[model samples]
Target: MTLSTDNALVVPHPLGLDYHISLQTPYCILCRYAVRPGEIIAAVFGHWGSPSYLAYTLGFSFPTVAQFEYGATVYEKSRSTSYPWLFCRRSDCYNCATLHDTSIYHIDCFHIISKNTASKRPSLRDIWTIASWTESLPKTRYQAPPDITLGAVADETLIDDHESILARVCSIPQELRDIIAQRCPESPAWRLVSALSRWRIFQPLLDPDIEIKGFSFDDIKSWCRRDGMVAGSGGSGKIRIQLDDLGVSRLDYVNDSPALPTAASRSQNAWFVVEEVSEMQEARIETKGPFMRIHKLPSFHLWDTPVPPDPALTRWNREITGNLRILRIRSIALKDITGLTVFCQHGAVRWIYPHHEETFPGPYSYPCDNSPSMAQLVPSAIESSSVIAIFFPLAKGEKISSVWVRRCEPYDDSIPDTLAVITTRGRFQLFGKYLCPTRPEVHFQQLSGNNTATHLLFQDVDFPFQRVSYFAAVSASVNNTGISPLAPSQLAQSRGFSWSSSFCYVSIVGLENVELIWLFRRQVPEGTPERDRLCLGMMLLYEDGTLAAAGNCRQGPDIDVQVIMLPGSIHYKISHKAGGVAVECATLDGGRDAILGDEEGWQSIDMHSRSEMRFWFDDSRTIWITSPST
Candidate 1:
């Protein structure tokens, strides 16, 4: 068959680039099942037959013309049965005794007959026979002249050429070919060609003829060491050379992370171990990253020598050795001497002494050498007119050892002068040749004396202080205040009461008089007795002189008692009396307020979530909380 010149190969689209590859067409078949092109054509023509009528008038089969139709199948079913029925069935028509649709099938049948007519053209081989010229013949014997095409050249001469059919081979160099013939006599020319081609492709890097001279044994050895040939030398341990030239020693790590020397026998010539530390002037620990390294300082000091050594190494031999002892000695006063004692009634006081000018130097010193003072004596001052008794021992040498005293300070807002006088003994120094080995204990005695005596003698004996007491009472409902019989029925059925998960409660308005008594005692005794009976401390008399009490009466639950601060120090009795519980006050400390664990009481229920309690204050001269409101 003759080839068609009109249908050339499909070239890529001309985008600005010289060569281009087309984008892959998406395969609808691969992604999902889809209707065939024939089905789609049938559906479109069957629905609208404008193109089908044109095909019939043009003498073409409707099926063949519909091949180029552009449409998609709308409905899904067996297209084979559906399409044929649509094409064959019509209003009225008969073919081969069977009625078929003429209107629909006319256009598609015309194109099918046109394609069959085009297939009857002359073949290409028949035309080639009439135009043939060249022929071939074989020679059996006799010699003939070499048919060189160029020398006997003619416009249309037929030459028997074997170049296309015969196997071709590239000749190696004559010298190399002779050498191969002598050395590798078993190899054929084709095999030799193949071996050379393979060698060029696989081992193109085989010994190139580039001259490299002037390198001696020592120079090469030194170069190898510089390139990391020494054992345990470079950054990591392993040879730095290529694998092919790596002798017999297998490298542990042959990476490019900085070469290292190999230490195996086969690599003995490849590396050398330096017994001494190398002193290079440029050797410095880089502080570029997150860490810092301590590098050996250059042996040559900058002030002493300007230029560094040639081999530039460090003295790695010297190290600090042998026993090194640290001694710590503290010198203290050998003997105790007289010291001053002070008692202040109110304000705070502090005192310090300086013996002489600082004896030590530098940053650190004993007794704070940085703060030097020569002051030898100081005096006292008064914030208010309060008594202050001070006793001091007079020391001959002035080396005072210890100072002690029992002091009392009181703060009274009524008295304008609240602070007492404070006396301080200043610094003193004793002259001596040597410190005494034996330490003498000196005692300082404080006697009852007064700086402001008149104030103490005329001051009032008692002071007014705030006192708090507690009273508790329960109600059936949050806002209700009514009392009922102490029974389950009274608590649950009464209109004045309410019920909770655990208890039924009724309002107890009259039971709000539960009072609290605070009894103060210095200590708790083993058994109950008259001597242990605490006296009435402070009558927590509200201006009315009646103690405030809180009530706790709810539901059918009886009043539960909790021991407050001390044993019998504070006690309460709850009874369902007509008017409620009566409260009283008593003291267990005779005439004094409780020192510590003594006063105990309860507080009234805080309706608004705010409650308070009060008790006598101890010698601290401040009121204490007997009970807290709940």
Candidate 2:
């Protein structure tokens, strides 16, 4: 057969002796020319250099060009090869198949004639030849090599090897090392390396083999005796004490808070056993049945020494171990001590003793030490205050069972009279009067379940030096086991006590043998309002005095009273009957007036008629009652 070289690769026919055959062509080689009746087609060879060399003996008659195109279309649409195409030696073939893996042998033009295109179809051997050729093709597509420049190669060379990189980093100024470390990627390996390096630098200062002596709570007697002090008694029998790395003795007790009534009563039974005391610290003892009272001792000086004066005492200017349960200060007069830190199990408490040149030494006394002083620890103030006591609850459902007491020179009257109690749930303030002039005491007890009560006893030394005491009760209700439900009268007695400027009002009503108490407070605006404002809060008081149903008040027909006061409506109303009080708002002479009844007896009030009435007890005290005309 004769062929054109424009779009074909002509090769010697492997089976034919005198005739030539084209192995690769754009059109079908078998159907490119019509076969004569006396001539025979030659065998075509493919994949010249590939492992898979397929040969097809072409002896069949050629079909119509249209029929050939139809078969090519069918083959293109139906054929799926597992192997990529073999790379051709031709330059054009390489470029055209740069990113493709299809066969470049032009088999579609040769053997892919559709069966329905002609009456005579190719034999089975011819079909097998095409299938085998497609199967052996390569599967991976070719990708072009990336362009590389001499500058890029030079830049890469500048990146030092691992050893060189480490050496360079180590050689930099010490200050810059931290800057580099901060910019480094946050990988575990990098972090470990950094930590190890830091540890290496500080190795000389650390005592790797430092020995700490372990001791049980019972053994504390021995340690206290070493410092010539008596041991206290009545701690948890299961507790153990250990001397920590910082040369401070620590008592390790169970982190769990003491159980309710059982633990509370058990604590009272325990007391420190003191046989004798030093002259620097005094101990007052009174034995009355199982109870003993001790007078607070005055302050003493603390010095920096290898061993503490008392092993039971906290370290000076160092953080106490976090696991300490009970911290008993032998000297309760904490007026001049500084840098004394105590870490409670639930929180931390630090003392800032008042700064005085005569009371404390000058900075030159401790030249090498850089620890902060009491004046520096707190915000700049003329005088400092010592945190005398701290109380906190230990259990999950427990109310704040803690109190913090501070003693100052009583110069700043702006200092709040209340102490903020922080618990796991939140924080609240407890306001009370001083119980003692020298020592203020606070006691917390769980009445029932999670319900707690606090008793504060302190002398009011502000003016006439009178004795004062306060009792506060709160309900946590985490567990069920305590006080009975609260009555309306009980709730009235508990409400309306405010140390802050916020005004509180309580109204009680009885219906169907059930008493209900509603508490109301005026929302004070930050700035003076052009008109008066009124807001109401309703609450249901249970028999145990716990408040519930607290929500905003809505005006409706079912409501007993809708309290709304306008501007210039400030007035007081006294009930004729003792202990009978109410808040009423009415329009008198086309002006609104709100009246709040006082807690004292109101026998002097004349309420016979619903008219505008005013009572002047003195120049400073006045009472007014106004009834709107209906």
Candidate 3:
């Protein structure tokens, strides 16, 4: 496309974006063009080869006040205690070209710093700075941070593409690697960021709908402390994890919480709960004697007197050369970790004691007797849990260039439940727990946008840990742009929801009220002659939807809602004129709130009781409340 203004380089890195910009108003570094939410077809200049090659958007840090190791809580680079901008380049590309004089680490390892001479204006990366929306510009596509956040669907509908993936699935070994490397629009987030730094871009965006700074669980623990008392890091007593009042109780538990039995209702979920849900109803942690658990390694023609410098391990170590990432996983249940084995791309190594003799299934062991869980025991995969083990091996010669992990709790969440072990044939062999528990079969509850209801989706609880993304919501939201994209995972091994390219706007009607009327998805094509555009109708009907909160980022004041507590009276549609769907009349009677728009181009809506439309939203699809069974 032709540019009216100079555009930033739209280059495609073999790797994805640097840090998927967490800030909302994502703009082009060069032109400051504000990318509209759900805008798919935009482009930037290339960093290297082509004009519009697809690449991930990189991130830069915003400079702010400082706290030095010498115990001074003050702004940095300041002249005296005031006149902060007395020295240094005063410009707005953020610390794109500066260095943090305070850090011991090299500039590359630290967040770029701004000098005392910088302007007082907030940087574009500032969370408080809401980005200004631009008028409709020439349609174009460029890789931006929003694009990386799964904020919008990258390409068009990919529903029918996965079936075609069978070709690569059964392709010759030589071709399989090529197939995996080729960019498949079906799951660009995973493929592009599979081995890259911005892998968080691939994580399934979960909910709360707020801006989350790069922080660990420990950080949250400190912030949530009401008394503002932090344990002394240098103290020598029992480590007091100062995380209390989170409702994570240890009162109720399974009688035998340590054994998985046949023909019993044992949900392997208790092991993964990091929230209030802490009960694992049916499934129990499989343990033996004083030993908590034992894992059997791949019994090949390998290792009898297994000790250090084993032949298989040394050989595999020699053959393996490239970036290596290890993700550690631990259960909420503490267990004594003993000897184990690590299977690499070229060979496998058994790490056992020198005097310990081993055979076919002899391997690592864990023994511990403690139960402190964060989630309540739910009998199904109705909610998100961490008790999963899988590996995503890179291409034959490709080492995992980047890996993304989350900080759960116990700090040991650092442990990875799954590993992408390299095998002799350079394949990813999962070396952790079995994908499914030893029970006959598992029936997981579906996520039907309702927390209290239950819908049994009787199928194998297949954890799409590798291909699917997972994340939680934020504190607040405006347009729900940052809401984690949701898909009906059980209905399909759904990678994500698909959408057609169009001019779409999302209006979250309620701010703090979690009642009916969640979002309004309006698509208006440009240049559609106003006279010809009859009733650009926007229908948003909600029923029995008790979502916690709502937000909208678009700039339109057409809607004015007032709430007065009355049975079945939750949402009220005053008016909306932005889309030519001006409300000609609105009335509340009998329990139904009816809205009638102008005749030339009208929009109609009804907001009422079970009549209150309870709906959930993703970037792509809309889920209406039809029945609790859904």
Ranked by lDDT, the better of candidates 1 and 3 is 3
Q: After superposition, how far is residue 16 of candidate 1 from its true place, in Å?
A: 99
Number of colliding residue pairs in model 3: 63
Cα lDDT tens digits for candidate 1, 69-138: 2211111212232232223222121111111111111111112212223222111121111011000000
TM-score quality measure for candidate 1 = 0.10
The global C-alpha lDDT for each of the candidates, from Candidate 1 onward, is 0.19, 0.25, 0.20
Q: What is the TM-score of each candidate against the true structure?
A: 0.10, 0.18, 0.20
Model 3 alpha-carbon drift over 4 Å, by segment: 1-561, 564-587, 590-630
Per-residue alpha-carbon lDDT of model 2 for 164-276, expressed as tens digits? 33335445665555555544322222322332232222222222243323222333332321242235442442222222111113222332322211111111111122212
Global CA lDDT computed for model 1:
0.19
Clashes (backbone N, CA, C under 3 Å), per candidate, total 39, 28, 63
Question: What residue runs in model 2 are displaced by over 4 Å at the alpha carbon?
Answer: 1-398, 406-408, 411-419, 433-630
The worst-scoring run of ten residues by lDDT in candidate 3 lies at 131-140
